[model samples]
Structures are given as structure tokens and as C-alpha cells.
Target chain A: MSAHAHSEDDHGSEGHDFAHPMSVQTLLAVFFALTFLTVITVAQASFDFGAFEVATVMFIATIKAVLVMAFFMHMIADKPFNAIIFIGSFVFVGLFVIFTLGDSMMTSGSFEPVVEELAPAVAEPMEVKVDGAP
Target chain B: MSTIEASPEVGHDDHGHDHDHDHPAFLAHHFDTPEQQFDSGKLGIWLFLVTEVLFFSGMFCAYAIFRALRPEVFEGCSQFLNTKLGAINTGVLLFSSLTMAWAVRCSQLEQHKGLVGTLAATLSCAMIFLGVKSIEYSHKWGMGLLPAGLFAYDPSNPHPTDHPNYLMYICIPFAIALAGVLLWLVVSAGLGNKMHVAMAMPLTVVCLCFFVGVGLGMVLESGDETAEHIDVHADPNGLASAPVMLEAEKAAAAEAAPAIAASGAMVSVDESVLEILAGDASNTGVTSGLNALEQQNAAAGTSTITGDEAVVGAITTTEIDVMTPTTAGVFFSIYYCMTGIHAIHILAGIGVLVWLLVRAVRLDFNRQYFGPVDYVGLYWHLVDLIWIYLFPLLYLIR
Candidate 1:
């Protein structure tokens, strides 16, 4: 297709079929949805859900990311290749988190004694570390 | 097409590859079609975003490790963070992302005016985020809520033993100022005339020496003074029972919290206990150490000292010593690492957006070709996406 096949922009283009890709209405709607979800994130923070806190907050954030990618960023309408490239990053990030968490939980109790070791260092008098033993 | 070709100032990139004059000027000579060019750029940006995610994932890993290892400290530290400000920053970035998205759409539809306006708005919002961040940082620094190494001055920590030696009251500000100057000197040397590097090099050494010399003097002098009082109590092997003595003092002071609150009217402090609060002000040049505590207490009003005569007792006579290390510092280290790296991306986004804005004014992007705007929009959105996770992790974690 010619690059300027339907490039009658800003004026005299009303009758052209699907001349503009995205509508102002959709952008505004996505904007409002994003703002609403932000409010939800803040509100949910005040409550105690025990084990659900991290999962719930992260889930909400994922929804927010999806909205951003799908509508506002127009990733929904992008070519499958571009969409894959974007979504692929998140997939890898997810895997990274999963692997790290899995490994850490496998040896969880090993870190329990770390607190006792760290707490005493503060009570000791300040000695400049780099200037010593030379 | 003829009009577009005549405007080749829209950043023409061609390495011995030439496009026909009919092609839009922004198109590279190497690409057969504008669609192909846009596709290539978009793919490159997506890959860059991938690297960004991987880059930030390291910090996230650090955050996860620490949060898992020490949830209680993380919770205690989170309480110090102002949620309202974090929420405000989140709102600002969200709105900026909206504007950024709108800008991309504006470029695609050939609304040059809207494009410029949205880009400007996005830049302003980025600036606003940074401004709020700097304010939060300064407040933390002033209160001594620093990361591990700089943990010297928190007047707000409640327990005086949590604060580092009082000598840092002078050292922190002086050292920070000198370090700032040294940074400025280094930046100037790098950016300015190359001929002056010889002089600048020596000056850098002088600044370094002055910093080390003054810091060493203060530490040694203060170390001597601390030895006279608390040194005998500290075991040279570091396993010594000085902490036991500290524990006893903390308990006694904790009990006196109420007595000090009532002291203005009906209470009087024993001279020995008074020494803890006042820190021997008669020692020349040492103003009352209680000033930070008093100010904090006055602000906190925890003692309900309703009258000027009501003196909150010196609950802590911890005359300046290095505080015991707390895992809370790890939380801040991750905080700075994550947010600091993110802020750098925001600054970079602003730079790219500004470039696009200037080009937009030049009528570089329109319905036929808005690849740069689209590319930057994607990058900015990724920055926003990172913040979406960062907000909950660093600030809103329950």
C-alpha cells in the first residue's frame, strides 16, 4: 500500500474509512481506568490480608500493566510479532522471579539466623573500615 | 509525498543506501518500506525493554531476598515511608503515561499541536516525579534514616542507641558538602576544557585529602572521648558485655519515659539520669545532645508534654556511638537501587521525548510515519510499568 494512500490528516479526512487508527474516546477511557486502578492499589494497601497481600497487590499491578499494554500503548492492535516482543519480556521477568523465589524458599530457614548476626554490628563503636590495618 | 521528501531534515539515515524522493524523509535508505522501518525500530525498542526488565530484575531479586529474610524489618522500615507521597508519585507517573500514550496517538493521527502539548506535559510530569523524590530523599537524609553505611543521624529512631555518634552531626553535612563539591569538580573536569585537566587532577587530590583528613580527625578525637566514657565497657574482642550494660540503661530509660513527661510540674531527674539526656553540655563546643531528641519529641508529642515546663526525661543517654546494624538498611539499599535506576530511565525518557517534541514542531511525524513517537511511547510505558510494581513493593507492602 502507498504510504500516503489515506493521509488526508486533521481535515477533509472525515469520509475516509478508518483513516485514524485509535479514537480519542478509547484513550480517555483507558486514562480513566488507569487512574481508577491506581486508587484501588492505594486503598487495598491499608488492609491486612496476611498471605494474600503480595499476591493481591501484584495481581492488581499486572491488570494495570495489561490495560496499559492493550489499550493506551496500543499493543493490542500491534502486529503479532511486536506484541510477542513486548509480552515476551514480561514472561521472562516472571520466570526470573519464579526461579529466584523457588530457590530461596527451598532454603528458607537458612536466613533466619542472619538477623542476630546483623543486629550487633550497630552496637559496636564506629571504626572507619577502609583506613585500618594498612 | 513530494512535500515529505522536501523535508529531509527529519533525520535522514542512509549509509550509501538511498530512498526515492517520494519516500518520507524519516525513512532510512536501507528499508524498502516505511512499515518495515517502523517494524525494525519497534523490535529494537522491545529488545531494549527486555534488557531493561532483566536489568531491574536483579534489584527485584535483591528486594525479594531481603523481604523474605526479614519481613519484620521491612515492615518497620515501610512505616517510615510516607504512603501519601508514594501514592502522589504514582498518580503523577500514571497521568504522565496517559499523556505519553496520547502523544503517540497524536503523532499517528497528525495532530502536531496535541503531540507537542502531550510531550511537554509528559516531560513536566517526569520532572515532578523527580522533584517529589528529591524532597523525600532530603527529609530522610536529614532525619538520619540513611542506608547502612550512612546510618549516623536518625533523630527520629526513638532509641538514642540507634543513632550514630554525635560527632557526625558535624561530619555528615561537611562530608556531604565536600563530596558534592568533588562531584561537581569531577563533572566539570570531564565536561570542560581538556587543557585544565592537569590543574583539575591535582585539585581533585586536594579535595580527597581534605575529606579524609577532616573525617579521620573527627573520628579519632570522638573515638578518644567515647573511650573515656563507654570504651572501658566495650570488650576489645567485640563479644564484650557493653550491650548488657546498654540493655540495662535502655530498660531504666524506658521506665523513666513517664517520669520525664511529668517532670515539668511534679518530677525531678537524678543528676546521673540527667547526664544521659543532656550529654554533658559543659564539654566545650558540644551543645546539648537533647536538641534532636527534644525537637523530635516536641513534634511527636508522645509524652503529652502539654506545657513548656514538662520535660520529657532523657530516656537515652547513649552518648554518641556507632549504632548496632539493623537489617532495615537493606530495605533502603534496595529502595535506592531500584528507584534510582528507574529515575535514570525517566530522565532518559524525558530527553528522548524532548527530541521528539522538537521534531514534531518541525513537522517530522505525521500519519504516514510516527515511528519515533511510537518507539518512545513504548519505552515510557515500560518505565511506567516498572513503577507500577515498584510502588507496591517499596511503599504499599502490607
Candidate 2:
């Protein structure tokens, strides 16, 4: 029965109706790779990478995500249109993060005035209350 | 959703409506062939997955914005998160992804038994992840590490005396579900129904996995706490000394200062003496206040001093703890938001996986009708993919 199913799979592969059955070996390999990357990311956290810490961690994570997308998710065998739209979502996410992050960075200076004006107002009352309490 | 519910009756009803096309029972009336139906469903699921990606992107955006803005807060709060549990959960979700993908493959190859096993394994992993997560959440809540409005974490005495036993509350639902599954197993065995027995057996194991997760979480959390305790006591010059001094100051504030101050012995206090005193003071409670003062004098190994001068000295030399609510609470808010929504997705994934499991048990899937399993597999993988990012972002923060 298994041999017959394999033959059918082969025959169907010539047409467009075949199911993409990923080999067990490939699945295990991807799992091991992901696990290894997880360990590496954890170990990397113990080190002080200075300014590149976030970038380094995110880089390893992106690699793991791509491995998951390509192999476990079978994006390699999936229709190009599906993969395209899925990856396109990330493009939009990038734009969203960049725009919002950039805007916040650009306007962060504007917060200084409010914070400075409120600091004395908040501090003076707290000091007065503390002195008056005793 | 209706398409995913392609039970035999639904398939037969569709067949009765379209006798001309002679398609498989699983194929809908609108599709020309099983392949067309499969492709259409696949496309639809991918589109849904894209929306899921974008939906979670908003939280990631919030995380990035906040982390970039207050890197220090992220640094401080991330320390409270147990890295070991995060790594374990990452491995669990990744393994579940493997099982899910294998289930999809098994369905494609018409391996019903293997499909059932893989689906069960995937569900169990999800349960374990939630179990560990509940431990993480409750432990934080016990420490008063809540969101901005509710944050009351005291650095000096993190484990408050009155915190609720959150683990017991978390275990109640799992315990009930386990009992229910066990009852089903017994009744099915007594009735001598082989099918019900088989289903009940795996359901029983899956239910037990939740407790296994809870047990695992409790053991690891306690182990972490013990390690932290030893770490504090092992180092005299460690930052642990500061919290000890703060504890002493707190003890003195409880009305023991003036009476001891009237004795008027001004002995200088060192870090080690203060640490020893604070350690005893914190453990002995308010009633042990005088005893702790006597121990402080002995531990000082010098001329005895009154408690008032010691308390004043400790207060004047207090170290600043930056892990206050206003600073660290915002990080926890994002932490809870991102991981909370992700856990909800895992829960939703479990619901759908159970649906797939039922269908798989009925042998409703074949080479051409395996779209449901495949779609759910895709969703499960996307959930894991999000965790792949979340593990590092939240746990592996530098």
C-alpha cells in the first residue's frame, strides 16, 4: 500500500494536483537548526555587544524565521503568489516600524520642554509635603 | 469555516447537489476538482496568515518603539524574566511546529495513525507552553510585577507575605479537565467501545501534559528562586547588600529606631554586618526587630551601637534601585501585551488543532482533501514564527 501510494505520488507530480509531502529528515533537520539557533541566541545575551546587541539578536531570529517559513511552512513548494503576499506583509511591517520609529525619534526632542517644566512643579510639591509631614 | 467542517455528511450533501461534476465528497460544489478546491483553500489561508502577520506587526511596532525609547527599562525588566523558561518554551513551540508539519506530511501520504500521533504531540506541546507561561505570569504577579497602574514591586522584599498562590489557581482548570478526560477513559473502557477508548487514551495524555507543564514550571521557578537566594547570601559586596540595608531601614521605620537610639552607642556599620543584619531582620519580621539589632551589633564585630544611629546610617548610605514601577512597568506592559496576544493565538491554534484532530480521527483527509490540516499547520507555523522573534526580543534582551 505504501509503495502504491508512492507511485501515485510520482504520477501526480507530472500533473498539478500532487501533494507536497516533506521528508521526515528535512523536518527534523529544520527543527534541530531552529533549536541550535535558540541556544545561540540565549548564549549571545550574556555578552555585551554594545550598540549591536539588538541587531545581533534580531539577525539570528530572522534567520530562524526564514528557515521556518521556507521548510516547515513549505514555502519552497507553495505557490509563488502565496509566498509573495506573505513576504509582502513583512515589507509593509518594515515600513510601519520605520515610519513610526523615525517619527518618534524626530519628535523626541519636543518632549524635553514639557518634562523640564513639569519637573520643578512635581518636585517642589513633594518636598513641601515631606517637610510639612514631620 | 464551513469548508473546514467537511465532515462526511456535509460532503454527501455537496455531492447530492452536484452529481454532474463527479468530484470527491470533500470538494465543494463551486470547485471543478479536488485540486482546485485545495488550491483555493490554500490561497485563502495564506491570505489569512498574511493578515495575522500584519496584525501582530502592530505589537512588534509597539515593542520596537518602546525598546528604542527606553532601552534601560527593557534592560532592567527583562532580568526578571526567566531566560531558562523562555528557552524551554521556544524549544517546545519549535518542536510542536515540527510535529504539525509532520502531521501535514502524514495526511499527504495517507498515514492516518502517524497523523493522529503527530497532531496529539503538537497539542501536548501547546499545553506545556501554556503551563510554563502561566507559571511565568503568576510568579511575576506574585512579585507585584504588573502593568503600569498596578505595579507595586518592592526591590527590598520582592516576595511579599500576602501574595496569592497563583499556581494553585492556574492548576484548577487543568485539574478539572484532567478529571473529565479520566472519567471519559474509564467510562469508555467499561462500555467496551474500542473507538472511544482510543480517543480517550490520547485525550487523557494531552490533559496530563498540562500538569506536566505545571510541574515543570513550578520546579524551574522555585529552582530559580533558590539560586537567587544563594547568590545573594554568597556575596557580601554584591548589590544584594543594598537591598539588605533597605530592609533594615524599613525595619527601623516600624518604630524601633528611637528606643534603640536612646542608648547612644555609635558603632560604624559595614556592608557585611548590614547584610547579615538585614538578612535576619527580613526573615524575622517586625517582632524580631530588637533581636535583629542585637545580631547587627554582634555581626559588626565592634563596639555596640543603638538602632537609631544604625538606621540613620543605613538610610543615608542607601543605594538607588532603578527598577521602580514607573521605570520597569512599561516594559512589562509591552511584555504582557506581546506574549499575552501570542498565548491567545496558541489557544486559538489548539482549538483549531482539536478540530483537525477530530477530522483526522474520522479519516476525513486523503491526499486531495488534506487542505484543513495543511492550513492549520500553516497557522501553527506562523504562531511559532512569531515566537521565534518574541523569544529573543523579550527574553534575550541585552
Query: CA RMSD for every model?
Result: 14.6, 11.2
Off by over 4 Å in 1: A1-20, A108-134, B1-22, B153-324
Model 2 over residues B126-209: C-alpha lDDT tens digits? Answer: 999999998788777876777754666654455554666676787798889889989988998999987777777787888889
| TM-score per model (chain B) | 0.56, 0.74
Tell me the tens digit of each residue's lDDT in model 1 across A1-134. 21333344223222222223567788878878888988998888766687799999989898999998887667766666767876777788778877776677675542322232323434332321211011
* Runs in model 2 lying further than 4 Å from the true structure: A1-17, A109-134, B1-21, B227-321
Q: What is the DockQ of candidate 2?
A: 0.29
The models' CA-based lDDT, in order, is 0.59, 0.70
Docking class of 2: acceptable
Go through the candidates in order and give each one's DockQ: 0.22, 0.29
Superposed by TM-score, candidate 2 places the C-alpha of residue B56 at a distance from the truth, in angstroms, of 1.0
